[model samples]
Target: MIEILSPARIERARDAGRLVGTILRTLARRTQVGTNLLEIDAWARRMIEDAGAQSCYVDYAPAFGRGPFGHWICTAVNDAVLHGKPHDLRLSSGDLLTLDLAVSLRGVAADAAISLIVGEARDAQDERMIATTEQALAAGIATAGPGARVGDLSHAIGTVLAGAGYPINLEFGGHGIGSSMHQDPHIANTGRPGRGYRLRPGMMLALEPWVMADTDQLVTDPDGWTLRSATGARAAHSEQTILITEDGAEILTLPNP
Candidate 1:
């Protein structure tokens, strides 16, 4: 279902978006070498509760996943990318971790994801992968104004990833997000411009551009939720929830302070 927010609803969305961004930034600062993935999930739960918000992922069960997610946040490390279920693994230096979070505050939902290196040791390839995703995300956001086709956003995102020599995966991408975490108008990482759904004011979209270092193929882990690169190469993902306004797109999931 596609949801368009009214002016007042947009305000509520901004609040939800800010909360998600703040929680992600807090988690990024707290995560380091020796930190357990479960601990990170616990931290996220506490933050969400303290803010009087709900986690969109906690009871989320979709066809692709095993069952209810049963977690507050997604912690994907190194080869793991999307739908990363938190496990017993402890983060180590140089590990590339992606934190994907979505929360509902006052009945509005906002989703965002960030990829960062765990500790001091920074691998060049890992850094490049992370940077490329971020760049692609920025490009996608830049093309998200009203009247812009979903394909325009996809083309902008795909240009960055392809230029960086990374393959694009269409199995999972961005989508409309509002009262729920995932909604209609699927936005791929790469596509032909001037096609697909046309943007309109008050429409919110979560544009995420993710890529594996060597392959576009993905393999589901034994856990049935975590999706990893088929080649076991490092991966990165970047995302933001944006609202299409009359003049342009407003990014709701920007970090606070």
Candidate 2:
């Protein structure tokens, strides 16, 4: 489904995006050494309920994942990259953690993710990987706007990641988002420019750029959800929901400064 939200609907989406952004920021602030992954999921659940918002993940039953995610947020650690199901594991200092979240408010949904080093920084490579993903996300956003091609955004993102010497994983990337969490117009992390869907006003896209440190291969964890690097190398992911407008792209899920 490729949804072009109306102005009013876009406004509602902005609200949903704000909620998602706030929750991610709150989690990042509250997370530290000894914090359990399950604890993070619980915190997300409470916040979503308190805000009268619906979690896009908790009851999610996608073909790619086990039925009913049963978690409020995805807590991907170190080698783990996408679809990370929060478990009983406790966070340790310098653990590269990625928190991916989505929520619906007023019938509109927004999704975003962030990767960071928890507690003290021990690995410089981890810091670089996180920074690279962030930079790639920014590049993707910068290349998005009305009349632009999805491939342009992908190219921008890929350039940043490849230039940084990280291997790109195509198993998952960005996508159109609106009333539901994931939608059509699958945006790859890397693509040839001048190809793919053309951007239009009122469209919302979740542009995520993730990479594995050493190899491009991924191994599914025993949990049947979390995706980790095959080589056991660390990984990083960054994302933001943006609205394509007449002028350019306006990022809807930026954390509060």
Candidate 3:
């Protein structure tokens, strides 16, 4: 369902967004070589509880994902991208990691994701892929505003990723997020401008741009939740929950500088 949040509800959403941002930043800092994916999930649960917030993934059940996600955070490493279910794996140096989180506070929800390299080692290609996704995310947010078409944001994001020579996947993308982790108004990573749903003040949407290094095809892992590149190519994903406003869009989930 499409929801246009009320002013007071927007304030609640801001709080949710803050919690999501802070948790993601903390997780990124704590993650490193030798870190266990399960430990990361445990950390997320503690943080959410301490803040008196709720984790959207703990009980997430959808047709696409295994029922009751049973994890506090998504820990995607290297080839893994979206819906990465936390598992028993210790990260290694230079591993490209993506952490996607969604939390609900005071009944409003916010979602965001970040991609980073674990440990001291970094590959040039991995760095470039992550940077491109971040750039695409920024471009998409810049296109959101009252009266703007969803396609405008998609086009803006697609331009950045496609220009970087990465293939775009439409199987899963961003979506409206508020009160729940996923909602209506599906936002594709690539689309024609001046098409799709029209934006209005008080609307909140999550714009995520993800890409595979060499292909657009995805293969689901045996876990039934984690999605990986078909060619085992490294992947990167970036996202933010934005609040549509009269003049522009307010990015609710930006990590501290």
Candidate 4:
């Protein structure tokens, strides 16, 4: 559903967004070499419950997934890109990890994701991939505002990713988000400007830009959820939920200070 949030709903969205951002930041800080994926999920669950918030992922049964997600957070590692169900694997130094989270507060939901390298054994290419996705995310968010087209955000993001020589997977991208985990106005990573759905005040969108180091193809892991790069190349993903306003957009997922 394409929901133009009411003022009251928007306030609740901010609460959801703050919780989501705080949880992601806490996870990123607590994560390190030898940390198990399941541990991350556990931390997320604890935080969500303590805040009286709801996890949008746990018990999530979407047609694309095998069944109920049955996890509190997505712990994508290395080649794994999206819907990365947390498992029992322990992370190693230099491993690229992505944490995608969604939370609901008072019935409003917000989603965001971040990719980082574990420990200090970082590779130049890995750093570049993560940085590229972050840049693309910023570009996409910058292009969003009232009266703007979804294509404008997509084009802005695509330019940064393509310019950095990364292949983008289009099967999944950003979308309008409000009362639910996902909503309308599917925003592709690449598109022509001045096309697609036009932005309006009170609308919110989750703009994510993800890319792989090599091939554009994606393979589903045996877990029936984790999406990995076809070439086993390291990948990165960056995202933020923004509110379109009269002037421009606000990054609601900006970490809680």
lDDT of 2 by residue, 184-241 (tens): 9999999999999999999999999999999999998877899999999999999999
Off by over 4 Å in 3: 255-257
Q: Tens digits of per-residue lDDT for model 1 on 17-105?
A: 99999999999999989999999999999999999999999899999999999999999999999999999999999999999999999
Tell me the deviation in Å of residue 12 in model 2: 0.5
Weakest ten-residue segment in model 3 by summed lDDT: 248-257
RMSD of each: 0.7, 0.8, 1.0, 0.8
Per-residue lDDT for 82-181 in model 4, tens only?
9999988999999999999999889988999999999985789999899999999999998999999999999999999999988777889999999898
Locate the minimum summed-lDDT window of 10 residues in model 2.
248-257
* Tens digit of per-residue lDDT, candidate 3, span 151-243: 999999999999999999998999998888899899999999999999999999999999999999999998899999999999999989999
lDDT agreement with native, every candidate: 0.94, 0.93, 0.93, 0.92
Provide the global lDDT of candidate 4 against the true structure.
0.92
lDDT of 1 at 243: 96
Instruction: Give candidate 1 misplaced runs (Cα > 4 Å).
Output: none
Q: How does model 1 score by TM-score?
A: 0.99
**TM-score of each predicted structure versus truth:** 0.99, 0.98, 0.98, 0.98
Q: Report the lDDT of model 2 for residue 5.
A: 95
